[model samples]
Target: MTLTESVNLDNCDREPIHVPGHIQSHGALLAFDAALRLAACSDNAERMLGFALPALGADLDAPQFAAWPHVTQAIGDFAQRSHGTSGLAERSEVQVGGRVFDLILHFNGRLVVAEFEERQPADREIRPFTTLANGALGRLRLQRTIDDLLQVAVTEIRSLTGFDRVMAYRFRHDASGDIVAEDCRPDVEPFLHRRYPAGDIPAQARRLYVINTLRFIADVGAAPVPVHTAGAEPLDMSWATLRSVSPIHIEYLTNMGVAASMSVSIVIGGELWGMIACHHLTPMVVPYGKRMACDVLAQLLASNVQTLLAADHAKRIEAASSVRVQLMETFVGGDGLLAALRPHAAALCTTFAADALVASEGTETFVHGGVSAAAGAELLRWLRSSKPPEGLLAMSEQAKLPPVLSAALAPWCGILALQMDDNRHDWLVLLRPEQVETVAWGGRPEKVYKAGPHGMRLTPRGSFDVWRETVRGIAVPWSATELEIARGLQAELHRAGGARRAQVARDRDQMLAVLGHDLRNPLQTIAMASQLLARGADSATVGPRITRSSTHMARLVSDLLDLSRLQGGLGLAVEPKPADLARLVREAAQDVTLGHPGVEVAVEAPPQLQVPVDAARVRQLLDNLLGNARQHGEAGRPIVMRLEASATQVTLSVANHAPPIPPESRDRLFDAYKPASLNNSRNPGGMGLGLYIACEIARGHGGTLVYEYHEPFVVFVVTLPREARAAAAGEA
Candidate 1:
């Protein structure tokens, strides 16, 4: 669609309404460069403005325009005040041709385009318009709903402009407009419920609506005045108040029998939401001051409407959040997401304002609310087949669906589907019933194409008679808030699923690592000893080695059996007899040295310290702790032990020359099946259950075991009651 192309119904959208090269007859447009040299002026400017029209005019210092210094002074003031911003247009009045005229000035690049319309003394002044606008804004602020707000607007605009009819038109998603609110005189025919097609306002015109807040036509039948410019390129009148509109639009008004018209754009979030349209049966003009006041009201109305909509979404989001909490409660209470959704189906239906839901997980399908089992199956099938790459799809008009599928889910006009996984097998589908609405159009909402003398062209509809339409297979559209909530729900479910899978995998891998490491070395040593004996090596050399290896393996196997029993809720068994705790710790160290001969051990204790503890279990606990130190401590560094006794209890601690345990693994150090380092490259033969068994042994004697990471050292401390007979009995 280029400027050179002839406009038809197919290409009118590119008709370029901004640089029209003309302006309305009621006003003269003059554009001057930064130096105040006239750059462009309307052809009628010589008659309207006493100054001669020049193809390239002289500067402000020229003798021709020296008499009226106010015009030049006003432009200088406007430029100084509106320095860097090219925002809204500013209005003022100047004396021209011995008559007062309204002046509107705005910037288009470096040029200051000014429009002058002859003003009458009867025109409303600026002070009264300020009072009128503030009063209208006060009324607007009192209305809570959009319908009420627009109702007040049309009434106020009609009263101010004295138009026969004034209406607030709201655009639909398709750009067609509906007369939502209207105020008119008694004799005028009311178009209160009329609708207009998008073609009535072309795309380029809509773009200008966002920039120019208000435009007026004193008389639609008046001829347009052409603008003459010195430059080769056409002037851009995007911000010019007197900028002319498309001839097709003028034809549209004349066809509708309108003599005069005015429109104030209702812009929201920088897009044209609609307009406040005024129509008159006789030629009429709204003074500049009054029109500016109406523009302010239109802007305020748009802001209030946007505020109302945001408030509605906020309420809905709050309620949906509460329902989500209840759903989560059900999810954790038992049989997976499907079960959770089954009982809360009615809640979900209300949360999103939906009619029914169909949830599918693998082979299982759950139908809830108003959907029949058969309809649920069909909906599920469609969701899986049409799953988007991101796995969320929303359809507002089910008439767009295939005929077979649409018939299968009759009476439903919307479907919102969320897939549970990357594969399309699982889904949660929300269904909404069709809302059939009847709309009344001002005329048939379409273009009429006919062959003209020049070529084929599109014409405006000839009639303004009422045309009604029954719109069907469309539900209330899914809102942005509902879609955002659905996205959050899907993401949360995926995160929970990932966490569950990781935990299960982690547990299994840790167990396998421990079993492969702890049993491998002992089994290998026994195998080597048996081979050496069979190859005629002396029994004296092999027997003790084989016996020691067998003992270690047997103890490991027994400890594993005890853990298996623990899983069945049994406690470790222990017999308490008075014994020297110091001796037990010493013996445990000596045995660990036999396993790792190069490792050294040191003991610091009162040798005679005694307690009612099971000596064998205490020795086992010591052996496990010592083995952990030997495996992990720096080579050639000695493991240290210390013991202290009190009247009722005794404390024993083991210190090893090893790096401190990482802070993240500290809490789970005493838990079974968790290794010190997640990195598998650490020295092996540690089942990660040493601390668990030691803890259990301490519990058996009514005591506790704990670990701490001091810089450059790892320490395990144990505390036991001096008289453990009662504690042992309690454990049994």
Candidate 2:
């Protein structure tokens, strides 16, 4: 037979579990029509309820049911009170045939379903709920791993319910299940480590498992009775405790030699993660209270499972982060990209267990281990053509490869790649070699044909004989943790590339702005001076104008270059010698007075204040400061230049009467290209680089430049060491 024919794939998911047409022998079920007439009863009704099956049209209050008068009134009261709802009534206890039973009633469509189960004796000793629950919780808490936890859960549940076998079956990403942990009777064959296909529990059945956390079948071999209704419709017994089960499921259980079964769902993050399945070789019924306890246990276990999984995930992320830090450091500290990643290539490839790694930038390819150069080129071409997502792109099998590239990449079955840049064709690829794996399936995982009352139909596999198959053309599966780490690496690389591009763009724009605005006036002045000389104007007048314009242009260019060098991590080059500070201050003040003839300048300093310094750079520093004071300071105010000498340091203070600096601009005053104020109309000609250059000069001389606002005046202070040893050492 063909695979599909053998497993009966057509009927796998068609089983109507809600209307199974059967009920457990431990309970008696009866359905009444809209007229309140007894329409149907279970075949075992006479044995359990001490009453023969009622005729199809007999009244529900017949003489056989008169022994319990409460049943008739209870049904009437339920029908009246449960309006506009599911019509399920609260269970009531009644004595019939000298035996107490718990009666549950609910309306399904036009029929009312009543089910009865034998109640526990009044004198039977019951175990304390708190004791059992606390013990189980304590044992569960002591488990440090998921395996230990599952083992404890199945053992405790089986012990509590007295089932012959209990297994913790965990679902995979594809909805297939594996028996992770089990506790069964020693005489029975173990189902541990067994796997089941996803089709075994159809989609609809999985939905019901989520809705109803727990389900039980007292006996799989019990006879079913038709749930009759005057309208010829079947009742939906999805929520009924004693509802009949599907014949296919019954056959499935019987094939395994199981007479009863129970299942409790284990949900995590609002999704069904797995289930706790229980089975027995003989018919059995679990009490409501015990089932309630199992439900609580399942909930607690689900919570613990979430916590443990999160902890494991966090641990993996931490390890990956460490590796990422090392890789980034190497990339940043080395000369070229290929050379940087080369030293750490093995470490990077091992993160996801790939046999080879390739780093590609444009047409250049750097291989780490076993990947061929042709394969790398082909992979890159495919990646560029496909334009995959920004994060990690993973392919588990070579079949996913393009036809043109599949034969070239035959040695590698899997590829995990990440694009490092959004605008560039730079990629990091990890390749895994083809791995052949042998998987032991419970059966062929195909449907089989069978003869039934309705003629030939599809059925589930009846024989669970071990069927081993060797799977080829695939590599080892990539784990969630590995994929997460790959995504993180991709994000980090993208951010780094974006930052570098942004810096380059900023630099280009700043250069353009300076060339277009700040340098235009100086160049124009030179042109005007040359035109005057060419026109035979007075030689002396054109000479000074030409000299002044050229000097100004040179100073602007020098300041720009100095700022660039400082930013590039090359500090100012200076030479220092013993000099008279008071003389230097006097000369700087005289130069400022020449430049700004209208402004009054005052100098206060002791004579012969000697210090070791670079006189020219210090002069440049003073010129920039005094020039800034003239441009932004009040026009009529006197500028004060003061020099103070101490044992080990000299302080130069320049003060002017000007409006206080705005709070927003104070922090970025010494930053290159940052305007002195947002309202640039006040000081329009300045390039905002003077103060930045001044600060760099002061730092080069082992001094600091700072600004302070004093209500009516702003002060710029320069403090330098008297000996200037740092400047001398830097010069060397």
Candidate 3:
């Protein structure tokens, strides 16, 4: 039932406002086809142009065209000059009904449309074009800063147009606008510094603003004179100055108590940068000429603003480059990431204009600067939950943090974060303290609705009063340069850390390779010892020596099997069965003694001691211990082997004269780069893996291999349960 209802909430953006079916009452529109025939005209065409378009089927008489005969030649000249179906061409003047009018020519689709605007008394000579242009351009050229430029623009435009209020509204990054500068009569309330929501100017409206640089509404309340078409398509009045405004915009202006309004777009680099908006309390006309002058000023302002903004950004980046260079100088990978950053944490906080820095490696956390430990932990916890693998976050508000941590990290209003791992761990975070400020809005920006024919429809707020809000929990936004530098550092740290881990793994693999090759020596000894046993040396005496040598060879293959698999070699696996433990021990001693010709091994054990075990692996364990003793024990000192059996277990002791190993250095003897190599098992290998291999073999048999530095003799004892675990052997 209402005009605005046609442009309601649902179809606000989709509405075809551009092809609105009418023109304002102040002007009349006439559209003619290429054949010089009138196709459409406004309802008031007879009153404004002294003639009207004939009906769809009728023909026009020569007398009918006589009233506006100048239009025929004007259309041809306008079309030739335009080069396209856009941009209105202003005619000097046209006469109708004994009065002068301003006629603008343009094309809409295939039709040439001409809008004729009536002139009031004394309308033409407000100020000549050259005089107005020289004065306005000269005054604008004097402005030095953006603020001064905006202020002077609004002041001069108001003086030129004689409007009640004028403002230089600049768009924010969000597309919202601020009344950055204003010039109005003393009676008018000030709207300077007031903010308007982005919704105030919808997307489609912004697009039109750029296309039609000058917009004018002479009166808000008057109904538009509908256009009548005769066998023609709906005419596009996009470039027509007298096109009717959207009904919703009409109501919006009405609500503001603005009788007339005008605006000129400030477009820069093909974007709608801002606008020069003028408002009048009473119906007023901004003649087409005056509106064009304001349009030119807006374009000049946009160009100026663009240049100043670029200069500002360049200066900021130049200043920030020094800080980035300094940080990189201290960030080489020779020292680990945490170690390198620890001493510079405080300086980094200041460099980023932040209050704290927290670097976490998932397991360890390093914190520095003003934040408390609890707050730093809370920040790490937030990032650990929210950040994805190799993800980045730059938040300038504390409220975005989890509710639980909001209180603990309240003092920190912003965070720049980088996470390296997928498990939500390992992040470098910088936190900035809160910066509080007050913002003044044109009105409350909340959406309000009114009951309409189609349920609820969004309506403009009635008041334009300043609504103040104290904004807190916000921080100065991180600049593009700062973010770029942060990402660079993050990438470097991640690269260095990954390389270090890879290097560690390579070193470990190399050690295993050397350990596996060390097995060849023990294997050779077992071969030589077997030949002596086969030479008919008396079965009762040499039989135990043969069994022990076989056991030592098994341990050597077991240790090398895994290394072989890793290095593209063979795998030695096992299937356990019953075996004689005492005989194996004696055999291992024979091989070790043969390997060290200067040392003699004295075997002491029962002739037969049985157990369920990997017999070869048990022999291998003995070989490692005996060989180590033979190689490192004092020369000419007999290496002694003592074997004993119980109902549930068997025990073997191999002892030789040597200096006692210190307790502090004994723990890693079986593992760390062969501490056994100190005196017990040193070999041509990278780190003598003899002790470590011997220990693992004992474990695989559910047995124990232990080192005992009994005074004056370094001893290794092996204990085997009656039944071997064989779990390690099973995996192999």
Ranking by TM-score: 1, 3, 2
- Model 3: lDDT to the true structure: 0.72
| RMSD to native, candidate 2 | 13.6
The candidate that achieves the highest lDDT relative to the unseen native structure: 1
Report the C-alpha lDDT of model 1 over 1-732, residue by residue, as the tens digit: 222335585667877678888888888887777777888888887788777654566675566667767987887777767664554467778897688888888887667888888877787356877898888899999999999999999999888778999999998877889999999999898999899998898888898888888888888877778888778778888877777767677667877889899999999888888899999978787788888889889989999999998899889888888888787665543334565787788988888889888887654567776667677777778777776768888888976888888888878868888887657777888889898988789999878776433345676776889988898989888877889888877776666545644663686487766666667878888899899999999999999988977787787687777666543335567888989888787778787777678889998988687788788888889988887777778888888888898897888888888878866676556655564543345444445677778887887787878887776779999989887643324311
Candidate 2 Cα lDDT to native: 0.75
The better candidate by lDDT, 1 or 3, is 1
Quote model 2's TM-score. Answer: 0.59
* Model 3 spans > 4 angstroms off: 1-9, 12-15, 32-39, 55-70, 80-100, 106-112, 119-121, 126-130, 230-235, 333-369, 384-390, 397-400, 411-413, 418-435, 451-457, 473-732
Lowest summed-lDDT stretch of 10 residues in model 1? 723-732
Cα lDDT listed for each candidate: 0.79, 0.75, 0.72
Q: What is the C-alpha RMSD of each candidate to the true structure, in Å?
A: 16.1, 13.6, 14.2
